[model samples]
Target: MSTPAVRIADLLEDVPTASNPPAPLPAPDPGEAPRTGGSTLNITVVWGDLTEVAADLHVTGHYQSVVPAAAELALDQAISGGSRLIIKEHTKLGWIDAQLGEVTYFPCKAGPVRSAAVVGMGPMGTLTERRALQMYASLLGEAVALGHVESMATVLIGSGTGNLAVSQAARALVRGFAGVLALLSPPTPPPRLTEVLIVEVDRLRAEQLHLALITAAESLPQLRIAPRLREESGGRLSAPSAAVYALAALARLAGPQSTPTRDGPAGTATRDGMPEGPDRPGREEALRTVLAGFDPDIQGKVREQLAHLATVDRTDLSLAVGGSVGEYDDSAQVRMSVLSGVGGLRWAALTGRATVPERLVPVDMDLLRELVNRLTEPSVEDARELPDLLSRVVVPPDFQRLLTDDARVLLELDRDTASVPWEFLAEIQHADGGRHDPLAIRTQLSRQLRTPYARVMTDALGDAPLRALVIGDPGDPEKGFQLEEARSEALAVAARLKNLGVEVSLFVGAANSREPGVDPARRLDVLRALLSGRHHIVHYCGHSDFDFSGTGRRSGWVFADGLLTAQELALLERPPLIVVANACYSALLGSATGLGRQAQPSGAADRSPWGNPQAALVPSLADEFLRLGVGHYIGAAWRIPDKQAISFAEQFYTYVFEGGPGEPAPTVGGGVRRARKGLYEQYAAGRVPPDIAPNPKRWSSWAAYQHYGDASDVLVRHDSSGTTGGS
Candidate 1:
């Protein structure tokens, strides 16, 4: 399968250009001669017969379901065995079933072109300017893979049957071409493909196309755009130029060339092509860092910190270690970076670290499943071997060196490395026949997202009155899981927040009633509206599900209306400072074997153990919240029991609003740490509620609570006046 294109910035035009020719081609009256053309850095402008242009490959196009006149005669004769063979293939596959925005290659039989491609436009009369440009770009990529080329030629697409204005079409096409070129060659490497010759039918249209090239060249100064316009007879053709002058622009753009323009701050277009920030690393260096098994930013920071730590004598040491492992193609192998302070920081040769073992123990799934089943039960087997298995799988011997009897470490992880249950990493077995808890439980350990160093100092919401929105299940009790426990949990949290002087808005449906309350159907609209303001916190208690059938897994919350997917949530420009999703598997991400399936309408209590075999394996809402830029996110990775969740929430809020032991106004992580400790304390005391029996499994539930942002960022603060304050 082809790699998906990196996200394209929204269409833009205000890019700074290197000096272009003295004057832009004069604009043409509709259907007049082509406009004038200009030159830039690397991209050259020229107009001539496309059939006669010297290039590696030639590209043409046809509508998704319709073959226009331009592609009928000449294109048919250019391909091997003529157009009849192509027609037969299309007829057998059916037009609608054929791939869109793709190129079908045909070796040149009796033409100057070495190879030719017919790109598919969606449909006649239905193509938008954006679609046309995007398809053209994609076609170029396909042609490169087909011909293995360095140069190419083609006519302007989307201008003929699509009836696009010359100027607008040219701009779109040029942008598409420039975008591809940027992808192929950044600062790190020069492109393999060198030049693209665009042949226009008329001087007027060619000039318009050249003008667009000039604009693109200026905006993408990194690209060496040296544009020039010419006539069919090889004479210097000057005048107004049109943007829609070449079909091969995409293919040409795909050649190695870095276009340094980026969408500026706040999604605005910058006129200059230079990247933002003084510390921006070179493109090649960044790519190399990624290939070296870590995020470029994190790798740089880790390298610096490691060097410093080697000289420090501090007992508490944080670590960010990474190495190459696994297959190059798999993300799990590609991103092997792990940021951990749990049990302190280990000293290892950073270049070649151990990888997570494919399997930790010699056992069948049944045995593993049994072990999982017994985790919450009091009579659980002495699974001190759990940590041993984990250590072998992920932790290297050097990791143990960093450990102390009492180490408070924060473990940061890339998305792939985050999948491991680090909370269960510990040596339960000792020479004295005593078992140890996971390093996390033994130490003040927390998991955080691995972000750039610059963002680490970002403070939490200083908005006074700590605004909060609490939402609960709106699904029908009979059709969906009965969220009675969820509703009660929401109510309790809201009450606690309100009592603490927090501005809390509660949205929960009445128990067992299908009444309208925070309708899930309108989740997108509601979220857009709610997230628009500068709220300090957002909390939700509900069911969530994931779809894993597609290339990319999608996750959403179960609502009365529908599953509110993560894609919809991404629409918010400003997310709350802290998001506490008190839902099952809220701190997880979708995985192939995890919660990749839809939610089954089981009427289990809110705190029922997330018994689904796949539940523990997926990414949760907490991850999504963090990705969306929620300053602090708290979530549970497993099905948390109602009492435990409520207790944790109450304890967390108390820590944030009121002084706890030493911390007067605790950060979100601090609150979470306190709540988890409280749960652990309760578990150790065998203080299981009357309904549930005392078991080790009950204590293990605390491990599910996860925080995925800066640990030092306090959600709220309080002054000596005993009033809650914002921080």
Candidate 2:
């Protein structure tokens, strides 16, 4: 028996191999006889095209469906000349509609690689690290079964348009390879595949894969991996250069239909005489043209915004506005930048102002607090103060200019401003000379808090059906904190989610006859359910408390026996993707001393620990969830009526999964906006029940809800089976 060897080699053209030596592997002992039964394996990471690699097998990923005529994959495009042959082979073998982790092999007569293996990675939206790992393991198992594979080459599977990070895919590949090797036992012959080559075309991603592979190898000493680096001409453009070329080509195509224009009103010809219509070029051309006009420094900032947008949704307008807390209690320094891509495009356009690091605009924190307080108040006088408060809120002119009627706004705010309901702010004027329409109704608005620990989860929820843990009225009625309508709300939400292909676990606090007088919302059970990491969403329709005297970490949802504090939730290693905290002040991140008085219960004021005059501003349940890496947290900034809360939840989920058979998935932000608009329209039509909202002049409960996550996040993705689930 001999030790396995692994090397990473950079295949630079005409470069001396001696300049970048491979890590030395231990020589076999002279006394040891050559083992003919189990073959020793060697692994290498190289920067080149998969088709050019000389190996027994070449592996690539394919979606569940057969490859279409117009392929979007880089590998498919690279091998376009032989793609027809591959497709024909696939059809002949009945390889259409493959399942995730399934692999099929076909001989290749046109490429350096003797044969190729195509592995199903499910749909584009459903590719995850787990699935990638499974696919890799299956590829090896199938290769071993063939018994002819001596060497193999593969692209880093799921790292391209499949939406996986390069490092993640690389790690998954390494782990999968190791897992197969570990399973080889006595009487079960080890795979004859000795050499494995990982090919990557993009220089940057290749470097990332190289590092990731080396790191993965270091963790598993049994693999005995050695690393080397080189670069060679693979006759393919790097990702950046390819992107630039594509954009240029698109611009040329778009030039004749609509010319690039200077600043002007949207949907109309600009001052530079460019026409705006349905026939105008896509967002790619518009973004490139707009970006080219900016100075290098500003362009860099705009590109940063674009990169941020790529993680969520790239087509929506992104407005990142935030500030550091100031020396004074009622004032803070603010800055803003707006990025947009009006149509389907990979790049983003700078629509508003670029952020000026040196020039921080001062904003009145008092005005923002006043706005939240006013919205919480149930008085006509307080509601009338909205226009004045909004005028004094210090929104940037650049941001104001970008606020069009049809804009899909992704608003990123700082902790100081997170509590302020920006959705209710009416920046755009109405056409009929009436009160301005709120941004929530006029535009699809979503919010993200600019926190240090917040992150966007790129991996899809695994192959399992989407799951939700719905908790309603978790507090006992004897505690004087029970929500009368919350149980029904939970049932309705669970039913709707189930209809949309989500596996829902519903828990209600009150004892029921069906359960033989047993309560389902046990604290231990709820905690275990949340920490299980199986559920994609956690919807709580009950009472929640915010600790103004503390840092808000102690604040939590009230349960049957105890409060499930934010401090406890922070311990979750795999937090749910979305959390809907439909409770009073669940999203409030400011001083709660003077807000939501009308909605508070009798003696609720006495329960507050606000006697401390030195109490500082605190984070909300939403803030804690985001900090712990929940992708989206929808919560109310103030007290919301039970009926309004139910209506909002139904509307939100309905819009989220509203897509028909083959339509594109709707965004989380879009759903929130539609839900809010539905409530506002109801109010406008005088359909509001007087008991739910007594005063027409008071700020509507619809505006109390705030979405703290990527507006572009699609919770449910449509599939070929006509069902929607978290992908």
Candidate 3:
């Protein structure tokens, strides 16, 4: 196969044979090979530009709207038909076709490469090395099945865009190749792919990557490995293109593998996202024990909230969002479990599909991320298409029927689904000619942060007038833009609390001479001291971090000195009743894997003494609060504007604390609900401030706020009246 500009055979024939061959493959020790006969895969690491690598297939990784310039430049020059501009245009337009991990292959017009495949890796914030490996393995399997790849090359997917270290990146690549080898086993003559070239940019890093691959190869005994370097640059490898390769070695380590069957036991469940093992212990006994330790009156109120949640006579459902790059499809798979006592402990696991549109593909996933992104931020022309977009997330028919009864369904969504604004979903069209948001009619929503400990909070919240640790503008002042509205927002909230007979400890940006030692330079120390006091609420009004550079499940406020991660939050002896992290991406969940990229508990095995601990399976700032034994948490699920956040918080606190003359104080969930409603009403009535109101669509930020815990819980005044309010 040859392109118009160059012949494939000639390109392969041009390179000379290596003077020294790579190390021979090692055989498994006796009794190490599995009795289940299956072939292995061969993997190799070489240092060179992807364009220069002589292989049948090329794999290129790309961020949402970004293409590697150097790689594109090489393709442009090698191809006869396109200019630099044309190649760039194609690259940009091509992304619309893939959400993530969907490979699009383009034939080379010039260069030595025969064909190039682009694998979309959504964004740096969400792309984990594990996910990269899965997608890469799937792509490899596809290429081999097509019977077209004799050899292939793949760029270090997340190394550049995702800020992954060379060793971490190489390890994922090696495992991905190994998985393909393991999966494509048997007497069926193996894939023609006999060589894999792991390509990187710089030689020093490449040498490091080679060492990592060699380390990985110790377990894989099917192929020899070698390192190839550029001859002209004194053993250095540099080319104006992305490098790619395939694994020739595969591993079939003989070991006992536990395969849990779908119908194995009453507590056992398939990988279909169903709840297993008679509910987490934290959900029942642990929580009950914690509640028992609370003061009598506070304990009574806390139990009342729990009882209210338990009053649901209808089905209880848990929705877990999952995705995979299937051998064919590229979309999300929604797994659900319905538990109902009405039918005597009946439970069922449901599977549903949600598709991604080609246009306006998801670049950054926040919540029902792929599904929600389509509806939340639409172009002007697509505004009228909102209802159609919402309809794409079709609830399974049986699930819909479950919602029809007045039992008040309890919907417990995992962090991913929690990010989606289910309140705005249009399940059906109305007679009035518009669809109603499903949340308006049915389902009581709350996030299942996976840890439950109501007892620890009841005592601290005992009849206390909400004492708040209010912080504004935690971002670095000298280097970062000022959050002008944050100070005002904090002051307004403090004033409101005071008016409602609550104690407020407000910390604005270092301008306050009244409070000594409370400057931006000692942000963390100041916060630790303040939190040491008896406070029921901690409201942060500033920027929050989404990127995690070092180890652990850590993300926090961007203080002037450094990041205020969950580790510091762990220092709090008594957790607050509620925490309001009002910042952009403050509520985003961490990795879905058991080890999250957010915060780890103090005593967890993964906790690193010197660095941030590996994030627990549920890694969100909100989750951190829950882990700290906080009762309730409210945070923005995605980026929010200053005015919207301020207005929402103001209204939310007002409803929670000082209610209108006739109305009773709103419950935590009720307060949040009304806040969203009030914000939406303000938008409709043209009452929102001009700076943020011109675009009605911006009001969607109201829907982005998420609650993580018992929504019925309320903050109570320490006064004899014991009035319950928002924290």
Question: Which model, 2 or 3, shows the larger TM-score?
Answer: 2
Task: Report lDDT per candidate.
Answer: 0.49, 0.55, 0.49
lDDT of 2 by residue, 521-552 (tens): 87788888887887888998877755434422
The root-mean-square deviation over C-alpha atoms between each candidate and the true structure, in angstroms, is: 23.2, 18.2, 26.4
Pairs clashing in candidate 2? 6-226, 8-228, 10-229, 10-230, 10-231, 11-230, 11-231, 11-232, 12-231
Model 3: how far residue 345 lies from native, Å = 21
Query: How badly does each model clash, as a count of residue pairs?
Result: 61, 9, 33
Question: What is residue 714's positional error in candidate 1, in angstroms?
Answer: 1.7
lDDT string, candidate 3, 436-551, tens digits: 33442233344544334222322344564557778877554555535767766766777777777777777767443223433442475556654575788788777665434456
Candidate 3 at 108: error in angstroms?
A: 80
